[model samples]
Target: MGEWRDVFDIKRDSAPVEEIAARIDADSTVKGANLVILIMAIFIASVGLNMNSVAVIIGAMLISPLMGGIVATGYGMATYDMHFIKKSLVKLSFQVVFALLTAAVYFSLTPITTPSPEMLARTAPTAWDVIIALCGGIAGAIGNTRQEKSNVIPGVAIATALMPPLCTAGYGIAAHSFHFFGGALYLFFINCFFITFSSFLIFKILRVPVCGGVSEAHFRYQRWFLIVCGLVVTVPSLYMAYVTANENIRDSQVKSFISQDMDLEASSVVAYELDHGVLIVDVIGAPLDDQEIERLQASLHQYGQLRQTTLKVVQGPASQLNQEQVQEIINARLANELKNDSGKSYKELANQYYGSYKRDAADQNLLRSLNRQAPVLFPAVRQISGGTLSTLNGEEETEGRQWLAYIVVSRQLTADEAGRLQQWIQTQADMPVVVNIQLQDTPSQFYGNGIDWNP
Candidate 1:
C-alpha cells in the first residue's frame, strides 16, 4: 500500500506555487515573439494540409504556442484569477483570429485548393479526438506544474493539435465550403474546450493556490458554465463518432462481402462505390446472368454487418466500363495504399501524394496555355483539353502512359493550321501526343480506352 501510494502520487514533486503561477502567466500572455510564432505555425500547418504531408504538420505543431495559453487559462480558473483569465482569453482570441485570417489569405492565393489527407482528417473529428484532447491536456497540465519541464509538453501540443484545424477552417473559408468550415471549427472548439477543462481539473488536483481571492457564488457560476459548455461541445463529437463508426463498419462489411463472399467466374472486381447504405461494385470480364447477381445479393445476409447494405453488381467487358470512373478508383486505391504503408520514406511518400497536385496544376496550365495559344496558332481550334491515357492491353495497362489531347472545332482546319497544332503539341511534350480533333456535332469522350485511335 505504501509503495502504491508513492508511485501514484503527483504532488510529491510539484513546483513552488509562485514559480508555477508565474510560468503559466508568462505562457498565457500573447506577445510579440509568440504572435509571430503563432502566425508561422499557421502557415506551416496550412502548407502541410495543402501538401498532405503529415511530418510537416507535426513540425508545425512542435512550434505552436497555443498550448501555453490554454494551460495558463486552466490554471487561472483553478486559482480563481478572473482578471488573468480575462487577459488570457482576450489574447487567445486575437491569436485565433490572426491565425485564421493569415491561413485564409494564404490558401486563397495558393494553387493547391484540393483538400489533402491532413485537411480531411481535421474536418471530421469524432469522440476519439475528444478523448485524445482530454488526455493530452491532462498530461500538459501535469507537466507544467512539475519542477522540471519534460517532452510531455511538446508531445501534448502535437496530440491535441490546435493549429491544423484552424487552418483547415480557413481553407474552408477560402474554398467557400461551409461544411468544412463548420466541421473544422467544431473540432478546434472541442480541442480548446476539453484541453482547458482538463487543465483546470489537473490544477485543482495539484491544489494550485488562489492568487487574490474567490467568492462562493462566482465559483459555483463558473463551475456550472463549464459543465454546460462541456456538454455543448461534446455531444456533437459523440454523434459524429457514431456516424463515423457506422460508416467504417459498413465499409468493412462491404469489402468483406465483395472479396470473400461474392463469388464470380471469369470476372474481376474493378471499382466500388458505397453510398447511403447502397453498395455498387463494378466488375469487368465476364457478364453475370441475372440469377447469379440475385444469388450474390441474397448472400449479403451471411455477413452480419452488411445485412442492411444493398449490393448491386455491375458486370461488363473492359471496353464497356467508364474509363474516367475506373481511373479515379485506381488512383484512390494507390494513394490510400501508399499512405498507410509505413515502409516508404516520408519524403518519398510526400512526393507521391504531392505529384497528384502537381499533375492537376499542370493539366490546368496546359489547358489555359493551349487555349490562349490556339487562336494564334490554329484559328480553327475553339478550345483544347488534355489528360493522360493509359495504353491498355486487355484489361491491364501494358504499354505506358501517354498524353491525350482533344481539340474542339466547328470545321476542318487548313493544312497550315493542322500542321502548326501538331508541331506545338510535340514540342511541348517532347513526345508524340495522341491528338483527337472533334467535329461540332460529335465530340470525342475517351470512347473505349482499350483501342488506340491515334492516326
Candidate 2:
C-alpha cells in the first residue's frame, strides 16, 4: 500500500494530458453523466447566487462542470483535437446559457435590484486572479496524470470558482444591467484563457505527442490564433482592473483625508458619495458650525480632484438625515410668505388664494385654516363621542354630549389649488365642536428632519 501510494503520487505530478484524455475516453458513460452534472451544477449555482446563499453557492462550485470544459479545452489545445474543442465548447456554452437563464428568471421574479456583497465581489477580477488560475491549472493538470489523484481537483474547483461569473451574468440579464454582463463575461474569458493555456504548458511538460500532419505550419497558425485570442480577451480585463484600482484609490484618499483633517469622528460620516467630478459628503451626527464647514472645504481642496464639493451636515444618524429637509425648509418659508401676504393661515392661503394643492394633507389643511379658508372636501374619520349634551327639560336637565375629535385628511394640493382651498376654507363657519383638518403627505415622499439632541 505504501509503495502503491508513492508510485501513484509520482504519476500524479507527471504526464497530465495523456492521463486526462485516457480517463475521459475510458469511461463511455462520462459524457452523459458529466453533462447532467454540469447542468445541475450550473442551475444550483445560479439559484445560490440569486438567493445570496453562500453555502449553496460553494456546493455548486464543488461539483461544477467547469472542470470538464477546461480539461476538454486543454485536450483540444495540446493534442490539436478540434472535435474535442468543439464538443467542450458546445457543452460549456450550453451549461452557461442554461445557468444564465435560470439565474435571470430567478432575479426577475425576485425584488432585489441592489447587488449583494457576493455579487459585487465577483464583478472586478484582478491580476492576482490570473496568478491563482495559472497555479490552480498547473496543480489540476499534474494531479490528473496520476492513478491515485489527490484533493487537487477540488482545490482547483474552489479556487477558480467558474460558476460565479455565469451566475452574475444571469443577475445582469434579470437586473437589466449590461455592465454586469460585461464584467462577468470578462471573468469567464479570463478563466478560460489562463486555465487552457496552463493546461497546454502542462501537456508540453508531460511530453504529450503532437499530431504528425498537423505540421509546423498548422502549429504556427494555431499559435498565432491563440495569441490573437489572448490579446482579444486580455485588453478589456486590463482596462477593468485599472478602473477598479482607480476607484479604490479615490475611496482610500477620501477616507484618509476625512480621518486626518476633520474635527468630527470618521465614524460620524453617514453617507459619502464620490462621483466622476464631484464629492458629495453627508455627515450625520451633530450639526456643523460655519467654522467646521470652512475647515472641511480647506481639507477637500488639498485633494485637488473634485470640481465641486457639496457638504451636507445634519444632526442624528446619516440614514436618518432627510436629504429633502433643505427643500422642505424652502417650502416652509414659501408657506409663511404666502400666508403673510394673503392675510390668512398657511393652508387657507394656499388652497383659496393660490389654488395650489401640491402640499400634503397635513400641510395643506393646516395652511388652509391659517388662511381662514374652508377645504373644498372634508375627510372622514372614526367618530368617538365624549361631550355632554343638554337634555330638553323645563328644569334644565343635562345629558352627556358626544365628543369626538374629527380628523380631516386632505390629498395633495397644488400651489393654485392650495390658495383656492385656503380661501374656500376661510369662508366656512368657525364652530368650536371638534374639527381637525390634517394634511398628510404620502408615506413614500415624507422624509422627517433630524434634529440634533446632543447640542
The best candidate by TM-score is 1
lDDT of 2 by residue, 128-162 (tens): 67777778887777766666768988888888888
Q: Which ranges in model 2 have alpha carbons more than 4 Å from their true place?
A: 1-18, 24-31, 110-114, 265-270, 283-292, 303-455
Question: Could you tell me which 10 consecutive residues in candidate 2 have the lowest summed lDDT?
Answer: 380-389
lDDT of each: 0.79, 0.61
Instruction: Write one digit per residue (lDDT tens) for candidate 1, span 192-289.
Output: 98999999998898887787757889889998999999999989899999988876776577667776765466887765655556776767877888
Q: What is the lDDT of candidate 1?
A: 0.79
lDDT for 278 (candidate 1): 74
Candidate 1, TM-score vs. the true structure? 0.72
TM-score of 2: 0.61
Error of 2 at 87 (Å): 2.7
- The numbered model that scores best in lDDT is 1
Candidate 1 Cα deviation (angstroms), residue 327 = 4.4
